[model samples]
Target: MGIHLHKLALVGAIALGAFGLAACGSGSSDSEGGATGVENPTPVGGSWEKGNFLPVSTFTDRCVSPRSGTDPITGSAYADVLGTRQDENNWLRSMSNELYLWYDEIEDKDPARFDSSLTYFEELRTFALTPSGREKDRFHFTEPTNEWLSQSESGIYIGYGVQWALISSEPPRKALVAYLDQEDSSLPDAITRGAEVISVDGVDLANGSDVDTLNEGMWPAKSGESHEFKILPLGASDPVTVTLVSAEVESDPVQHVKVETTDSDRKVGYMLFNDHIAKAEGELIDAITELESEGIDDLILDLRYNGGGYLDIAAELAYMIAGDNSVGQSFEHMQFNDQHPEINPVTGAPLDPTPFHTSALGLADDSLKGYPLPTLNLPRLFVLTSGNTCSASEAIINGLRGVDVEVIQIGETTCGKPYGFYPLDNCGTTYFTIQFSGANAKGFGEYSDGFVPNGPFGTEADLPGCEVDDDFDHLLGDVNEARFAAALNYIEGGDCGDVAVKAFAEFGTSNRLLESNVSVPKEISRSNRIMVR
Candidate 1:
């Protein structure tokens, strides 16, 4: 998905690690300790407690480092002021007080106390817990506007064209190629899926003490940066030394589109969708058009590594899948804070249902805005997931289910996120504070603990499907792969794969694997919940 990262608007403040339904570790730790108590309501015409007197506009666009030139992506001149860092902090506090979904729960601390706007912004989330005692708000984060804008320049990021699956982050740590960037073909052919990183820049990958060197080489700082790696290709006996030159890489959301014939002679389409970026609209339209032409009986939408992007794109994809069933239904009923129960806090529009988009709303290309989307007219959809399946990706599952389109989840539980935000840029930093919580048509979207597989199904509680571990040995889209095979088997006769593997893939094992998984980059780690206004 492209905040401008696509997921937070495509990628805004949702910076965090990647794993199965595990708790996303964010930098909101400074907000803990509860020393700052909750804010009390103010009289109708008066100010609230704890310095909540001023409006967010008083500090808007006031940055410590103001820009004077035109922005390359937006092609608009910046309107920044030579203001102090405290101005930025005041902006975050006032803005949070106005638009945050949990404004009342937040501890109203002083904006002038913290030196940096980042540390101050982190303290703006609620300290409330879920029914399970988990933190209610886990998606608060921020990134420099310059860094985010650079990626937005062309929806490109500089890297080795590899999405590494951190099977183990610590020693004897194991990192495998989850998948290669389908958008980049310049990467060496030897660096295919399942390839193992034995060493990075001569530093041993597994059990390497210098994580900094390994990380630097694994994720190059800039384009044209050269890094060496001793990689053991998939199924190879020995490792081979290769140089990985970083380049400006863009992610391809729709990849590995294939139509498979089952034993019953039924046609099933498998589309590995990785992001909800704008371009993905065209890519997905093309993919669905092909599948629809073939008259496929079923669709397996793989969203294992998807972190979400444009919500509109997600709605379009849902319409493409469910067709008339969700044509006029509420894709999501979004609600903001109590102060503005009937109006969207961010857009200031009267609160209304986000309809399951019938025609393309053109996120990728303005030319395709009103074009009708091609649909498989599927009654049931199969999803391949992992912890990486998040936000906009989760929205697909929830939205489809809202219209009673059967979703058979075939993998670990998803990253439960029923919240979305419009990435708001203030004074050189884009903040991703939770602005709204969404519910499906049946009034269900409280999945903060994620959707569990094998839980009581048909109740919108937990999704129904086979629970299996991710098989990295075989390439994705391969029917023999654990999750894919399970999906195929389920379609054949509702058969779930090996009991032993299913048992092993449950709670304890999933958590253990997640605990060892790799931490992603701050800028690129998080997917988006893009409010594309």
Candidate 2:
């Protein structure tokens, strides 16, 4: 979606002819780019220097793999020209320097030191640390246009219909099938939620040294790639090995919707929302409408595995949850670099606070627009979260908190990502660079360290909630799931439970707790706080 040319903005096409880049026609990059050599090798950024720079337009559309004719996605003419590693890298350098939120903090390293555009683009970010000493700009990265379009637009990916939960990534590791794509009917019956991954192929996952084989088997590069997995099925005494072939798995973002009548007679609505993709706009609306009909006493949104996609979707979700309390309130406001303080450098529009859109966004189909969204009008809400609850997921908590809507969080700390950018494509490669940081109403956006459960409530980034570990023993949205149960307990008791945080040393890692609760596939796991321009 390179900051998605869905709108197909012509970023000053005259510059292409001025620099004479159009003559370099139809050439493509064969380099499996990294800090590596190239197929069509040329001097890296040949004559470029560290401090000196050019207009961003000078190298725009100059691609290592330039396309011709019409683009199928946007129906716009392809504006690419064959270019070298230098042109591609230079464009990235100039683009980052001109529009990046922390452009001054970036080191203007010589592009000549980088061999491919990918390697050079990778290093062109501010190496600054947040107040918590965490990496400030963890969102800068790129993706192939083909893969990005399919997954971002349709939530499609090539895998075993499994969403892994990595309790420990290092050796003597432990992994579990945290969630499964309900859309995948071909998945083996034993590969249910809470199933532990003992090994992949013939290699011992707990103590094996061969990293490449394990990665390929678990997350195959393409479809029809079959691999053997030794799994310890949930509630089973013995482990069994099963062969799973990777296929195109489309995720059901909003699933497990039901109205639960608690013991105390409160009808609580629950849902397991995983992604914030385009289709979620309609699915969420449908879910909310369904929940409203049941007269739910309270709502618990399970967002533990939601890494985030579209900001508009988050804003819509906020509006649906808060209802009349959100009138005249801003969902989030954008803050750009010092150079473009008053205007969006990319869209060339006035800088403004993005309000909570009451109507459907029509992401999947244009005909779906103009319909008023159904609301719950609940005074308070509950969100089930974890380390994978990031970006737009975190925005929901922050935006709701900004409006004084009580958000009782249950689970570990949420992944902090308040920054967002438009995925921009240049010469076939989609680049995701942080261009803005968003603050909800009351202007509180500095949650780079993440919101914590049971954290000091007085702090802008802290919230009132219980600290509970993710329970893989039960499926998400189940009343017995650790986080969901904690939410239910809080509704009845209004106090945190005595659930002491525990670690799994039995899984083999010397480290007790998981590095991340939701295992992210590298293919689709980029900084997901995507702002569609």
Candidate 3:
């Protein structure tokens, strides 16, 4: 049988939201009762006995019968399945067996933490090949509940509906409401952006002992969980206590899109792209078409908070930005494990590099079918970023650079992740293991430590363009906002003058330690991901 392409639609809770499957050919094995006389080998202990290990095992049943037991401490019945501690060793072995890169580097971990499945998973990833000390291969997780996966894929969440930032780590730790999800109209008007979080669950934030309580209140596991918070409004001196109940919230990925005329008579298109979901593609196309009609001189893509989503959308966006200049060029190259260098493990076919997509995929109907992508066709592009910019968002920068397009990056370094996976649902939990590493047309994919700003950080190499700290004082999209101002200044042929290079010192070591001690929450803070399908 001929190999057919299969797309994997894995959605991350935090960063890159969606991913498209690579050009992998899927075909039946001759040994599986096909015309060929070759016999198929049996799988043992999650290891493949014959043929290509990855794709073959991926499609075949490779899992061994899990051991069962009872938890001594909790007296709960447990099965040694995918999410149990008894399967820790097998899980690690399986990850090492299939991970695209760094599999050989995984160290043997102790299985004693089997009582705590999440901790065991963490220990399993401790040996990942982290060249720059910043863990890029550290997204392996088991959700407390399966609903999180569906919620993430649908761009709906259950939380307080506020994105917060730890503003200070001094004696009195301070957190500020960075932004609010307006779609969650259930939130009180007093809980607007820039509001100060004074206390959570009656635990004063100034007290060092309250960190644990604060984190729990902020990231509750279930919807309808209520937490009492004392917040100081943006301009208020008195504090008001409010009990906020978590609820399911729908998000709008394209927060803002407009055409702005700079002081120098340049018609610039600005788009605040926050998430990469199904909805974003149409929004982006509409924005681009509008800008093209307005005869815009340049475009500014604000992805400072975009965690990433949908590789196809990323390619589409790149095509819209570069237009004809990108045709006939490789958009991205997916590199699977060493065993399958030229073949797609998922499809069992010769690997074909992904090219710049000219048309939208996965649309409901002909509304966007064969719609010609609008392009800025500018030689250079300005992208505003922060540590949160990741995955498919980075793909945009890398894909553009591969085609010799100038990408002027401003703000902080990105959460360097060039790896992606097809999320696997085993038992009751979703597992994300790096299955492929991506490269641009130029074959440059060595950004594991992350893409640094203007200068290099440790082993991470510096990217093209200057770096500037985020101006938190000014609202995002404002002309005076430090990052935006820096981009605008560069557009006007000016330089960032005397901009202080300050580290984001919100979460101190103690606070970080406290956070780690807590149980891993179902919701993730950053969605560092690449989804296929």
Task: List runs of model 3 lying over 4 Å from the truth.
Answer: 1-92, 108-120, 123-131, 169-171, 183-186, 363-371, 456-461, 497-526
| Model 3 lDDT per residue over 1-533, tens place | 11011222111210110001111111111112212232332323343232222232232221222223542212454332222223333443444455436555555544433444344445545354566555556555444223534444545676777766655544456667756655335677778756778888987775557555776687564688999999998768899999998888656666557677878998887877776765577778888888789988888898777767667778889998998899889999999768667766554557788889887764423467677778878777888877667778888888888998888887767767787765543323345567788899999877766666676554324665577765545555667667777777777775545554332422111123223211112233135454444
Q: Model 2 TM-score?
A: 0.89
Instruction: List runs of model 1 lying over 4 Å from the truth.
Output: 1-51, 71-76, 150-154, 456-459, 499-526
TM-score of each: 0.87, 0.89, 0.77
- Ordered list by TM-score, greatest first: 2, 1, 3
Angstrom error of the Cα, residue 297, model 2: value is 1.6
Q: Which candidate model has the greater lDDT, 1 or 3? A: 1
Candidate 3 lands at a TM-score of: 0.77
Candidate 2 wrong stretches, greater than 4 Å: 1-3, 6-50, 499-519, 522-527
Give the lowest summed-lDDT range of ten residues in model 2. Answer: 17-26
**Please, what are the lDDT tens digits per residue for candidate 1 over residues 1-533?**
22243211111121112222232222222221212232321112133358444665566655555566775435678665555556667777777777789888888886667876677777999888876676778678676666555443334677866877676765777777878767456777668877888998888877767776776777666789999999999879998899989887777778989999999999999989876767788999999999999999999899887877778888989999998788889998888878777766565567888888888876656788889888878999999887777888889899989888999998887767889887767655667889888899999988876776776644465888866887767788888778888888888888675633322222211222225434222233237576666
Error of 2 at 64 (Å): 2.6
* Cα lDDT over the full model 3: 0.60
RMSD (Cα, Å) for all candidates, in order, is: 7.1, 6.5, 9.9
Model 2: clashing residue pairs?
A: 1-4, 2-423, 2-424, 2-425, 3-422, 3-423, 3-424
